[model samples]
Target: MALTVSIVQLAISVIAFPIFLLHFLGLWDRTCKKLFPYFMEQVTKSYNREMSAKKQELFSNLQDFAGSSGKVTLMEIGCGTGANFKFYPPGCRITCVDPNPNFEKFLIKSIAENQHLQFERFIVAPGEDMPQIADNSMDVVVCTLVLCSVEQQEKFIKEMYRVLRPGGAFYFMEHVAAEPSSWNFFWQQALKPTWQLMFDGCDLTRETWKALERGSFSKLNLQHLQAPLSWKIIRPHIVGYATK
Candidate 1:
């Protein structure tokens, strides 16, 4: 019986080993592109419903801006699967920026549903570098749950600053690091490597709020809160807007 069980385990390992190697060798990018959006679609639906009140209040500011202006121009960094499309105000034109090109199809579908907002363009580039977008041309810049994965929050914030017109607003919602010495923080640190690998480069312990503060926006109105109970590790969050 022991030998039979050992052989079964060995066969399983042999079958799984090559797939793991392929994932490490960059073949996983294709699989991730196909699978992550489907996973995100379900996750975003829960987030939107669970955090409805907060999302509404935060997006109200942008709605006001769009209503006041004849044609408000908005740019969204890391606009994954266009999950925030339903929250945008009417008549606002949006520029979507995302490194994952696979998100384009999902974004188009979302855009079609939210016909109130105009889809100006989609740029396949990281938020840290978007020279194609003219400086001081955007009325609002939106970011949600993106800073945790960005290579440099400072650079990303600087890019937002550069692109926003005078008095433009940056709307952000992000999950950040838990308090030090806490059990959540310890788990975040211990599981960071595996978490990031599984979640497309997301860092569970990023001090994203600090990076936003370092940007010195003309007016910052950020507040700290805990994420939903479902998200145990990456629970600490900051959500609000800043004016450039």
Candidate 2:
């Protein structure tokens, strides 16, 4: 199985080289608009939903903010397809943000299905900087499976802290790199080139928890665990909440 995974990754690297070149020429994003979103939905939506549901405690800090605003005000960064909607408490007002404009139609579709929550608006912005959202306003912030793809981890975490209220909580779940000396780390590094090209800037070995600890969060609770996936290439996971 290990040999097979390595061979498959090598083949992918060979195939992705041309796409990587296309990316530099600015033709890749334009060409893969529909293909990327649909493929992402198919690949991650179900797995994300199931993992978030099982580790429901990540959102446990939300109750403290229930009556803070007539309802809990939540901002979800990189909220692709609105996949985490079902896991939120009832009546929460959610504001969605993502860098891709192509996801609006699909996000609207998901919002339509989830009648239990109220959506504030959808903003086309990356997680690193969201000046549109006022500072210290949101009661809670949520981001799942998105840190790996961001351009810079520290800037994104800092932005989350900036938008959060004095007592606001930021919930995060991400798949990270395995141990450096382990066999999986070898594959992660080997696959880095093609993997990032195939999936928009997503690194297989991002130690995001370190950046979170460096942020200005007043309190943080982080846990390391494995995601419920059959493959080890993307299974190392972390879930936690940081209070500002």
Candidate 3:
């Protein structure tokens, strides 16, 4: 049994080794883009379930401002597969930005299923550079589980600030770095190189909360929570909002 298990693990590693090598060469973005939807369904679903309450609260904040205007204008960065669409209220005019164009079809399908949201536009761009979105044009800026993978997190936050109208809220839910003494922290450091390569540049040890604070939103409210053990390496999470 041990020998069989070893062989199976070896075979799987061998198959995946070339992919990781290519990913490190900066040539894997396309492949990562294509695999994103599958990763959401297979990996993120369980994490979503474990953090459903926090997710609900993060989205629930929109309730206070929903439909206050003719339509609630929302912009989402790294809007992968539109997983957060169901949380938004009906008649929300949404602008989605993602570096990967492959997510367009998946996002469209999600929008169709949600029925509450209106698909405004899909821009094939990263969060760090969004010159097309006018200043103070958005009512809400939504980002969840995305900061972990962005190339320039600070620039991304600044862009969100620039695009949101005065009093608009930025909602976020992200897995952050574990505590220094924890087992997960050790493993996170140990596996970071491979993990980032395999998971589209996601960092397991990012201090995302600090970045949010640095954005200097007018109002900041945040809370930390321990993620379910199934996701230990990236277990610590911060969920809340910052208003500009």
How many clashing residue pairs, candidate 1? 0
Local error of candidate 1 at residue 83 (angstroms): 1.1
Q: Which candidate leads the pack in lDDT?
A: 2
CA lDDT of each prediction against the hidden true structure: 0.83, 0.85, 0.82
* CA lDDT for candidate 1: 0.83
lDDT of 2 by residue, 180-222 (tens): 8887887888788787777877899999989988998889889
Q: Which has the better TM-score: candidate 1, or candidate 2? A: 2
Which ranges of candidate 1 are over 4 A from the true structure? Answer: 1-20, 67-69
In model 2, where is the ten-residue run with the lowest total lDDT?
A: 46-55
lDDT of 1 by residue, 96-210 (tens): 9999888888899999999998999999999999999999899899999899999888988998899998888999999888988787776676666556656788998898888
- Count backbone clashes in candidate 3: 0
lDDT of 3: 0.82
Q: Which candidate's TM-score is highest?
A: 2
Candidate 1 vs candidate 3: which has greater lDDT?
A: 1
Please give each candidate's TM-score: 0.88, 0.90, 0.88
